[model samples]
Target chain A: MIVWTLLEWLAWGASGLILAWMVADALRVSHDYDEDVLLSSREGEMIMDEPHDAA
Target chain B: MAQAQAVTETKAQPIGLLRVLGPGHVWALGVGIVLVGEYMGWNFSVGKGGALGSLIACWVIGLLYTCVAMIDSEVTSTVAAAGGQYAQAKHIIGPLMAFNVGLYLVMAYTMLEAADALIVGDLVVALAAGTGVEGVDPKPFVILAISLLALLNYRGVLMTLSVNFVITAIAFLAIVVFFLSVEPWNPGAVLHHADLLAGLPYGWLGVVAAFQFGIWYYLGIEGTCQAAEEVRSPARSLPYGTMSGIITLLIAASLTWYVAAGLLPWEYLGQAITPLYDAAQASGSTGLQVFLFIGTLFAASASANGCINDAARAWFSMGRDRYMPIWFGAVHPRYRTPFRSILFLIPIAVSFAFTGLLDQVVTFSILSGLLGYTFMPINMHLFRKRWPLGSIERGYVHPFHPLPAIVLLVLCTATFFATYLGYGVQLLAMMSFYIVASLWFAFHRYKYVRRGDQFTMPWPRPRGY
Candidate 1:
C-alpha cells in the first residue's frame, strides 16, 4: 500500500514539474522575443547550412 | 514589419521549427507513429475477417497506403509545409478544405496520442501486476506519459524525433528478433503451421471487413510529410524518407503476419491484446517474451511521441494562418518548436485518454485518417491541374499520376463500407462530428481566416490563374 502511494505521488510530481517548466519557458520566450521574429519561419524556406530564407 | 525585417537581415535566423532534421528523423517520425499498430490493434482484423481474410486485407490495404505514400510524397515534395495533407489542401483546393483537413490531422493524431498513452498505462499496470502489485490505476501513469512527451516535444524537434528513432528501431528489431527466434524457416518445428493454419472462416466479405483493420500495418506513414518544414532539404529528404518508411512497413507487416499467424490460432490471435507478445509467450521462451514486452512499450511511447509532434505542427500551421487563435501559431524563440500548440494539445489528448474508450477512440482516429486520404486525390488533381509536370520545380514527382489517385479512392471507399459494417454508429458519429465542426467553423472562426494572403506558393503563378 505504501509503495503504490509513493508511485502515484512520484508520477504526479514528475508530470507537474515538466508541465510547469514548459509553461514557464513559454512565458519567458514570449517576453524576450518579438512576435514577428518568432513567426518568421516559413515552410521549407530555410536550408540548414545556408540561412537565407529569413533574409 | 520593419523590426522583423531589420532583425532578419542582421541574423537571418530561421524562425519557426528548427531545420536540423534529415531523412533519418523523417523516417523515425513516420514509422514511430505507425509501428504501434503492428504491435497491437491489427490483430483485431483477424477477429473480423479470420487469419487468411486478414492477410488479404493487409495486402489490399497495403496497396491503398502505397498510393497514399506516393501521393503524399509527390505533393509534399512541392508544398513542403508542416501541416502535411492540410498544407497541400490549403495550397491547391481552397480554405474550407484546408481548414477541415487540418482539423482532421489534429484530431486524429491527438486522439491517437491519447490511445497510445492509454496503452502505455495499461502495460504499466500489467508490469506491476506481474510483480504481484495489482489494483494499480493507469490514469496517473497516462498523465505522466503525456506530460513527459509533451516536455520532449516542447523543448525541440530534433531531440524528440531522435529519441523516437532509437525506441522505434528497438521496437522494430524486436519484431525481427522474434521472427528469427521462431525459426520460421522450419515452420514444422515450433510453428505447428499444419495444425494452426486455417482457411478463411468467413468469406470474401470477411476479407473486405478485414480491410478496415488492415490499415494498421501501415497507417500514419504519410505523416512523414509533416516534417517537411523542419527537414534540412524537403525535396530530397521528404520523398525518399517517406518512401523508405513505406517499404520498411511492408516488410515488417509481412513478417509480423507470417510469425503471429503461425504461432497463435486465428481465433486467439484475432482477439489477443498483444498479439506479438502473445506469440512470443507461445514460443515458450522467457527471453523472447521479455523482448516483445519491451517492444510493445517502446512502440506505444514512440507512437505517442510522434503523434504529439505531428498534431502540434498541424495545429500550429492552422493557427499560423489564423484559422484558429493566432496565439497557437507562436513558435518558441529558444526551442524553435511549436511550443504553445504542443502545450495546448496535451490536455486535449489527456481528456481523450481519460475517456478510456480505447477501441472507439482508435476507430475514430482511423476513420478520420481515412477521410484525410480521400482528400489526397482531390488535392492531387488540383495540384497537377494548376501546375503540370515541368511547370515548376518538384523535389520528387510521382509517376502514373491519376491511377494512384483512383486506386486510393476505391480502397478508401471499400474500407469505409467495411468500417460501416461493424462500426456503423461510429461511422455516422464521425461524419456528424465533422458536419457539426464544419458548421461551427463557418459560424465562428471562419472570419479569422485571411482570404487575400493565401496561395503563398513560391512557384510560378499557377498556369490557369
Candidate 2:
C-alpha cells in the first residue's frame, strides 16, 4: 500500500512538471505583431478607422 | 503616410469578441489540454524509473498551474483582455516581471513546437514503416503535417475547433479502450518500490530520477490559460476547463501505467516503444495496434495543433504590447486569426524537426518551464492576499492549508535543482539564453519605446469622422 501510494504520488508529481514545462514554453513563443502595435497607441482614434469606406 | 492611413482605417471598426474569441480559439484551448496528456504519456514512458520521477515532478508543477488558472480566471472576468498571462502578471507583479514571464514563455513554447513536430514526424515514419512504406523521408512529412494543421487554422477558428473537438473525443475514447483492456487487477506490482539508493547512483538521487520521469507526464496543462481572451466567460470556462482537463489527464495516465505494469512484465514493457500497443497485442486483439497508432497520431496532432494556435496568440498579445515586433500580431482580414504568428511557428517547428532533436528540445522545454513555474505558487500567494476571498468566491480550496502549497513550492524548487542535476551544463546554457534575451529586450524598450504610452486603442469611437 505504501509503495502504491508513493508511486501514485510520484506519477502525479512528475506529470505535473511536464505540463508546467509545456505551458511555460507555449507562453514564451506565441506573440502577434499587429495586435501589439494596435494596442500601443495612446489615442483611441486608430481603432475605429474605416479602410474600405474611406477609400 | 502608410502608417497614418493604416491608423485611420483601424479607427473605423467596432470592437467585438467575434474578432477575438472565435471558434478556432476555443479549439486551440481544447487541443492544448489534449496535447499535454499525449506528450506526458509518450515522452515519459521511455525509462521506468525516470518516467516515474518525471510524473511526480509534473504533478507538483501541475498544481502550480492550477493556482495560476484560478487567479487568471478572476482577473479575466474583470479585464476581458487578450494579453492573457502577460496582462495578469503585469497587473499583479508589475511590467518587468510580466515582460520576463512572457519572454520566457515564448521561448519555451517555440521549443515545444519544435519538439512536438519532431515527435509527430518520428511517429509518422514508424507508422509508415509498419505499413511497408519504405524510405519515406520524415522531413517532408513533418512539414506537410504542420502545413495542413496551419491551413486548418487559416480557415478560421471555427473550422479548427470543429476538427479539434472531434480529435479530442476520439483520443479520449482511445485512452479509455486502452485502459479497459488492461484491467488493473494486480495493483501490487504497479506500486512496487525499493530502497531510495537502490538501482541509482545516490540514495535521494532516486527521488530526483522519479521526478524527472514524472515531470514529462505533466507537460502542457496551462495551454488553456493562454486562450483567456478567446473563451466565452473566461472566468467560468477557464477554471472548470483547466481543472477538469488536468483531472482527466491524471486519471488516464495513472490507469494506463497501473494496467500496463500489472498486465505485463516490466522488462518487456520497458523495451517496447509503445507499451500500450504491446498491452493491446497481449490482450489477444491484433487490431488494437492499429487503434493505438491512430489514437497516438490524433493525440500528437491535436497537441501540436493546439500549441501552435495558443502560442501564436500569446505571441500576438506580446507583440501588441511591444515586447515583441509588431508584425507578429497581424490578423488575417478574412480569417481573423494571427496569421503571421502561425506562419512564424511553422518555420521554427520545421527547423527543429529536420534536426531530429526531439529529446534535446523536450529537455530544453522542461528546464524553461520549471523557470516559469517558480512564479506560479508565489503568484497564487500574492493573488489570495491582495484580492481577498471576499472579492472572489473560493470555489475549490486546496486541501491541507499552506502545507500542500508549501510542499508544492519545495518540490518545485527541488525539481529545479534536479533539472540542473540531470542536465548540468545544458541547463546553464538555457538559463543564460533567457537572461540575455530578457536584458536585451529591457534595454531596447528603455532606449527606444516611450514609457506610459498606451499601445491599444479603446473600443467605441468618440462620435464623428
Candidate 3:
C-alpha cells in the first residue's frame, strides 16, 4: 500500500512539473510583441511602394 | 501552345482509393480495431485488482469515452475533412487554434505510429520466446513492419482498407470468442461489494487512474472522420459509422470485462501481463492463444497502416492549402498517392521506435488527443445553433440543453490538467516542443504567403453536399 501511494504521488508530481512548463511557455508567447506589429514590419520592408490589399 | 499546356496539366490522374467505404463501415473498422486492442490491454491492467472499485472506475471511464464519441460525431459530420480535429476546431474557433490542434495531432499521430511499432515488436518477442528462434531483437522487426505499412499506404487507400477489413473481421471474432468461452457469466461482479474497491492501490485516485486506461480503448474513434473524403455518401455514412463504432466498442468492452472477471480471481489479473493469454492457458485451449496472437498482430498492422494512410492525406491537404511545403502535397506520377509524406513518416516512426519511448509516446498522444477532444463539444454547440437537427434525427440529444457540452468541456479540461499532473516533466517538455514547432511553421507559412510565392497547385475548397 505504501509503495503504491509513493508511485502515484511520483507520477502526479512529474505531471505537475510538465504542466507548469507548458503554462509558462504559453505565457511567454502571449506576452511577446504583438503578432500584428510583427506582421506589418515584415510586410512594409517587402512590399514598399506597392499597394497591398487587406482582403 | 498555352491552351495545350493548360490541358495537359489539368489532366492529372487521381491517386489513392476512389470510394471503397461507406462512411459507416470506415467508422466501424477504424473504431472497432483500435477499441478492441485498447480494451484488451486496459482490462488486463484493471482486472488485476479484483475489487469492486476498479470495476466501477472502468465502467465510468467507458461512459466518458462514449460521451466523447458522440461529441466527435456531431463535430465531424458538420465539418467533414481529412484534417479531422484540426478542421473542426478551425471552423468553430479560428486559424490559430486550428493550427495548434493540427500541430498537436501530427505530433500525436507520429508518436502513435511509434507506439504501435513497439507493440508489434513486444508481441513478436513474446511469441518467439517459446519458439526455437533465440535472442531475436524486436527493434529491427518493428522498423521493418512500419516500413512495410508505410509502403502499403503509399500504394493507395483502397488497398489499405481492404487489408483493414480482413484484419478487423478476425480481431472482432477473437474478442467475441474470448468473451463467450470464459466460464460463469457474472455481470453482477462489476457492481457488487466493497472489498473489491480496496484492492486498487491508488485508493480514491484509482478512478482517474483507471480512466486513462479505459479511455485508451476509444482512442481512434476520430479516424473515421479523417477518411471522410474517401468515403462514399459521407453525410449518411459518417454519422452512421461514428455511432456504430461507439456502440460496438461499448458492447465489446462490457462483455470482455464481465467474462474475464468471472473466469479468474481479480487479484491475479494484474500479475498476468497478458490476461487473455493466461486465460487461454488456464482454459486448456492453447489454440486460442495463437488465435489471439495472430488477431493482435493483424489489429496492430491494420491500425498502423490505416493511420499512415490517414495522416499522409492530412499532410497532403495541409500542403495543398499552402500551410505546408508543396513537396508534401505532391502526388506520385503513377500511383497518384502522397508518396513523399508517406516516405517521410517511415523515418520519423522508425526513430521513435529506436528511442525505446513507447510509454512516453502513448502518454503524450493521449494527452494531446484529450486536448483536441475539449474543442469537440464547443464545435458541436456552435454547429447545433447554426444548423439545427431535423425531426428525422435518430440520435439521443445531449440532456440539460447546453449542459452536456459544458460538462464535457469541464471534464476535458480536468483530464488535461490531470494528465499534466500525472506525466510531469515529460509533458512539459513535449508541449514546449510542440509550441516551438507550431510557431516556426506558422511563421514560415506567413513568410511564403507574403512573398507572393505561387503554389502552382490548385487550392482545396470544402466539398459541398
Candidate 4:
C-alpha cells in the first residue's frame, strides 16, 4: 500500500473543499433560480395589476 | 417562436448574447473546453516527472486552478459581461492591461481551437490506421472539422451548448470507464516499483518541469466566465458552473493518470497521443478501445466548438469596445449571432491547423494563458478596493480575500518563466503578438479607447442593453 505524504493529504483536503463548495453552490443556485423565476413572474403580474387598478 | 421572429424582423436588436444558458450549460461549456486534455496530451507529464512527480504537479496546478476559478467567479458575477476578464481588467486595472488580457484571451482560445482541429485530424488518421482503413490526407478533414464547428456556433448558443453537453458527457464517461477497466490493485506491483520512490522519478525539478503538461488538466476552466452574459443568472451560475467544472476536471484528470499509468508503464504512456485508448487496449478490451476512439473524436469536437464560441465572443467584445475593427462586432441580421466574427476565425484557425505546428501552438497557448492568469490577482485586489462587500450584490465571495489570487499569481508567474526557459523560441510567437497589438494600439489609440458602447454590467444595467 502506498502511504500518502502530508502534502498529498493536504492536496486531497483542498480538492475536497472545492468539491464540497461546488455541490453546495449548485444546490443553492438551483433553489435560488427557482425563487428568482417565481419572483419575476410575481413582479410581472404586479405590473399588470397596476394598470388594472388604475382602470 | 412567433414573438421572437417578430422581434427579429422589426428591428433585430444589435448584436447581443442571448440569455438562454443556465448553470448547467455553463458547466458543460467549462467541461467541454478542457475535455481534450483528460483523454490525451496530459500523459506527457509522466515523461518529465514519472508518475509521482506528475501527480504532484497536477495537484498543485489543480489548486492554482481552483483559486483562479474562485477569483474569476467573484469578478465575473459582479461584472457580468461577455468581455469577461478583459472587461474586469479594464474596469479595475486600466485600458492597457485590458487590451493585453483581451489579446491574451483571443490568442489562447484561437491557439487551442487550432490545436484541437489538428488533433481531431491526427486522431482520425491514427484510428484509421489501427482499423486497417485505406489512405487519406487529414488536412481536408481538419478544415471540415473547423467549418462544422463554426457552423454550429453561428447557428445559436443553445445548439452549441447542447452539442457541447452531449460530447462532454461522453468524454467524462470514457474516463470513468477507463478507471473501471484498470486491473484490481496489487500491493506487490507497487512494492516492486518502489524504485519509483513514491512516483517521483527525477525529484522536485522534475515536478517543476512537469508543470507544463500538468496545467493541461485545467487549462481552459476560466473560459466559462466568458459566457457570463448568456447565463440566466451570472451572479449565481458562473460560480456554480466554474467551481463544479473544476471539481469534475480534477477527478477526471486524477483518474486518467492513475488508471492509464497503472495499466501501462508511465514511460510508454508518456509518448501516446491517444493515451486513454492505449490504456484501455492494454486491458485486452476491443470494446473499450473502440469506445475510446469514438470518445476522442467527440472530445476534440467539443473542445474545438466550445473554444470557437469563447474566441468569437471575446473578439466580438473587443470589437464592440472599439479595441478592434467594428466589422468583428457584426451580428447576423436574422440569426442574431456573431456570424462575421465566427466566420473570420475559420481561415485563421485553418491556416494554423495546416501549419502542423501543434507544439508551438500549445506553447503559445500556455504563454498567453499565464499572462492572463497573472492579471487576475491584481484585478481581484483592485476590485475589492473599488467595490467592497455589500456595496454591490455578487455571488461566491472567495474566503481569505487576496490569498487565493496571490497564490494563483505566483503559480502562473513561476510556470510562465518555466515555460519560457523550456520553449523560449516557440513562445516568441506569442510575444510577437503582444508587440503587434502594442503597435496597433499606439497607432489607433482613439478607436481603441473611445468609449460610448455599453457593455453588460451587473448593477444598474447599462443603458441601451
Please give the CA lDDT of all the candidate structures.
0.88, 0.56, 0.59, 0.74
Per-residue lDDT of candidate 2, residues B107-198 (tens digit):
66666766666666677667666766655456655665666676666546656666776777677677687666554444343333231112
How is the predicted docking of candidate 2 categorized under the CAPRI scheme? incorrect
Evaluate model 3 with DockQ and give the value.
0.02
Task: Quote model 3's TM-score.
Answer: 0.76
Better of 2 and 3 by lDDT: 3
Residue-wise C-alpha lDDT for candidate 4, range B195-303, written one tens digit per residue: 3334577777887888888888888889998887777778898999999999999999888877776666777876787788887787777888888888888888999
**Highest lDDT: which candidate?**
1
User: Worst 10-residue stretch by lDDT in candidate 3 chain B?
Assistant: B454-463
Q: Please, what is the TM-score per model?
A: 0.95, 0.76, 0.76, 0.84
- Interface RMSD values for all candidates: 5.3, 13.9, 19.8, 18.9
Per-residue alpha-carbon lDDT of candidate 3 for residues B1-58, written as tens digits (9 for 90 to 100): 7654543443332223244566545754465446544424566336423334446646
Any runs in candidate 3 off by more than 4 Å, and if so which? Answer: A1-55, B1-17, B43-54, B186-201, B263-268, B385-401, B449-465
lDDT (tens digit, per residue) of candidate 1 on B168-241: 99999999998888888886898876787688887888889999899888878988989988998888999888
Best model number under DockQ: 1
How well does candidate 4 score on lDDT at residue B81?
Answer: 71
Best by TM-score: 1
Please estimate how well model 2 matches the true structure, expressed as its whole-model Cα lDDT: 0.56
